[model samples]
Target: MGPTGTGKSDLGVALARELDGEVVNADSMQFYRGMDIGTAKLAPEERGGVAHHLLDVLEVTEEASVALYQEQARAAIDAVLARGRVPILVGGSGLYVRAALDRLEFPGTDPRARAEIEEDLARRGRSALLAELREVDPESAERVADDRRLVRALEVHRITGRPFTSFMPRREYVRPAVQIGLGGPRGALNERLARRVDRMVERGLPEEVARLDAVGLRRGRTASRALGYRQFLEVLDGLSTVEAAAEATTTATRRLAKRQVTWFSADPRVEWTDFREPPEEQLRRALRRIAEAG
Candidate 1:
């Protein structure tokens, strides 16, 4: 529950081992199968025998839906609780984390309406769609950063006759839980991200992207847009070199980390730990927080 390259995965595994917990993944990009290297997905052995749910559930060609993810993640958490094990929800995807832990409501989509909006987007371009969204729902237009969200905001407005912001989750938790946020200085995080991208390249991120692209990776609405995967896909298309792609990936990843920090920092409930501290100290602080929450 922190920024990328912040050692969240390792901390989650450590916590799971201490608490007899199973991990329910909240990272959206890690949902796709065969996106291992670029996603920094932990291998089975690396999980320290703690079962992980919701990883490798989607094909490279399929789109990821937060509504569906909410259902799946909640079910996984319930099952883990039923088994008398702690359910550790781990990832840097802020919306997915909120959907799993908070009282967030997802409005039903209208296919016909969606199709119409998609047609409009294709015909009129993103600026036109953004302009229309601003006219109908200025808050949503101000918040939305991309085409997918812009289209969805308009579709939701047309379907529900309400502003998209109305559906945003409140800060109230759906259940008792403690969020452990691991973060460090911005310069340190930037260095970590750069090294991580270089490691991904050394571990065959380009090859992994090539294999997934052969299996329709580019067709995926969500998977194709992931940080390293997107940049490396350009490498596959001869639009960039591996070295250049790695550099671009590092930059994009740093930007994503910044956004994640901003999103999570806005929530007052999170108990943050400095990654500059020793790992055992971080774990001790997290365990103490969880105990206090109980």
Candidate 2:
């Protein structure tokens, strides 16, 4: 996986064509309908006749959690395998991607309690919520990186009525695929990200966001949280000029790319490729690795 606009979708498309495979989207944003451009979703012609699953499958009003994504993606991958072609999983959502390929098991949820916890979250942002979770479940907080994960921990604890620290016995998962990273030194990647932001604006990302609002995907839900969309929404609300929004998009995108770089660097399974490498070369190396696995 790579950062947004790091050519992940294009590489996935090219690789799917090369392998004669179906594309299963691992992107969290692309799952929402009417979010086409900002999520960098492939157009009909761009897909090159390859069947793409899990794109535009839900209304933007719907917010997908990792567990839901895993469930659907698993089904789609099985369908692709049944067709006797490779299933190419593509996107920058590391959590959904890894959850699908590695079969990680996040604990179950209790709906009523989840609602309560989410209410609590609204009242107190991640820090206070995390502090609360930490007081009750220090070990889980220690294991997970941040408060963004407190929601998951609280869900598990509230559902199971058990200490969140006791999740280790549930770590059984069978990995199904190889993972890799894309991009290079920070300076080079930032340049590429800026150019990508420019191109996205040129392609009318602002119009795309307005169209989503037309389709009643107006709320700042999960889909709207995709990089360029919300910035454009600010422009829609007259909170910022288009130029300001574009600059903010580029800045936010840079920070996201940096986080992605750090995430990939820490991931042992992800062999990386520099942005300078041709996509075909990266595809060839990946295919070779898969073949060797056989």
Q: Estimate the lDDT of model 2.
A: 0.78
**Candidate lDDT values, in order:** 0.93, 0.78
- Any idea how many clashes model 1 has? 0
The parts of candidate 1 lying over 4 Å away from their true place are 113-163
Q: Write the per-residue lDDT of candidate 1 for residues 1-294, one digit (tens) a residue.
A: 999988888899999999999999999999999999888999999999989999999999999999999999999999999999999999999999999999999998899999999999999899999989989899999999888899899999999999999998999889888999988799999999999999999999999999999999999999999999999888878999999999999999999999999999999989999987888999999999999988
In terms of lDDT, the poorest run of 10 residues in model 1 is 229-238
lDDT of 2 by residue, 1-294 (tens): 877666777777877888889999988888887777667788989988888999988887787888888888899999998999988888887778777777366677677877888889888877787777778788887776754567878888877777676754222335457665677778887888788788888898889888887776656468777788878988989999888998999999898877777766766777676657787787887777768767
- Model 2 sits at a Cα RMSD from the real structure of 4.1
**List of clashing residue pairs for candidate 2:** none
